[model samples]
Target: MTADEVFDDIVDDLAGRGVSAGKMFGARAIMLDGKAICCLKRAEFGVKLGAGSAAHEKALALPEAVLFDPAGKGRPFKDWVALPASQSEHWPTLAQAAVQAAH
Candidate 1:
């Protein structure tokens, strides 16, 4: 699926569980309990799955995943996972984990 398709799927799936979609930093973001769990920024997908958690470590283990730092070459956000297109298939699952981790 394309980026738009992926974003739609995530938004739809999350909505079923009471999460909503909104704009964050000019990108599409999944909002749960008023918090933004995941977002699509410039073709990259980002998830706030909590730093040091198993899910966070698992995401970082993927070659397509990295630390989310909007500004280049800086200390990355500790609780965010930046995912590349290569890991598209895992988006849904990771997005879910991010939501669960948020609580």
Candidate 2:
């Protein structure tokens, strides 16, 4: 799905779970009791997320997690880890990680 779709689905999903949802970086950010959990980011190069510093370290431990494409032009938004398009099932995993990072 597209970034906007990602944002919309995520927001609806999280909110359905009683999480707070809002906009960030022209995409969507999710929060649990006001603490961030994840976001769907729209970039010129591709759809991605900038899961903060703490999330970066934790996500590294997951088998499915990966740093965004090395050559990707998202250097300006450091600490971002890109999930491949094929890893659709991992969105929840990634969203959780993003929330972990923000918290």
Candidate 3:
């Protein structure tokens, strides 16, 4: 599925679980209690799973997965993972982890 479609599915699934759709750094994002849990940027699904956490490590192990760097600078968000379309299947699971971490 396309990134948009994947994002839609995540939003729908999380919405019922109390997550809201919002914007983060101008990108479409899933929010929990007003904090961004994940976002879609350039077809990449960026999720905040906390640095060094099990979820973060697993996500980084995925092909093409990387630390999120919105500005394209070397300074990346340690707690965020940027998952490419190839890793879309894992988005939901990681997104759930993000929500839990946020709580």
Candidate 4:
């Protein structure tokens, strides 16, 4: 999928689950009770959790969040990190971290 499609899918997932969300820097940003959960970039199909957001760390611990190389650097974080394709179900946890960083 294109980066934009990936980003939109994430935002759609969150919104589908009833999480408040928005957009910034052309990235899909989730908002929770007036807070942001994460920032998703369409070009890179990347999701950058807000500063101090623990979603990335938490996701790292799960097997679902495999480190993918999008930049051909063999580095997971260089270009983009693969979030669980099942992120829709993981929205609560992810969004919580986003809210934390947003606040």
Which candidate ranks first by lDDT, i.e. highest?
Answer: 3
Better of 2 and 4 by lDDT: 2
Q: List the candidate 2 regions with Cα displacement exceeding 4 Å.
A: 1-9, 16-18, 32-37, 43-76
Q: Kindly indicate the candidate among 2 and 3 with the higher lDDT.
A: 3
Q: What is the lDDT of residue 76 in candidate 1?
A: 80
lDDT of model 1, residue 100 = 87
List, residue by residue over 1-103, the lDDT tens digit for candidate 3. 8999999998998887789999998899998888888999988899999999898998899999999987777988999999888889999999989988887
TM-score of 3: 0.94
Candidate 4 ranges with C-alpha deviation above 4 Å: 1-20, 25-27, 31-36, 40-55, 66-82
> Model 1 scores what on Cα lDDT?
0.86
Which residue pairs does candidate 1 place in steric collision? none
RMSD of each: 1.3, 5.5, 0.9, 6.3
**Most accurate candidate by TM-score:** 3
Model 4 scores a C-alpha lDDT of 0.50
> What would the per-residue lDDT of candidate 2 be over residues 1-103, giving only the tens digit for each residue?
7655655676666565667766545545566676444555543112234445554665544555556444446453356555544555566666755544444
Sorted on lDDT, best first, the list reads 3, 1, 2, 4
Output the lDDT of residue 99, model 3: 86
Task: Mark the regions of model 3 whose C-alpha exceeds 4 Å error after superposition.
Answer: none
| Local distance difference test values of all predictions, in order | 0.86, 0.52, 0.90, 0.50
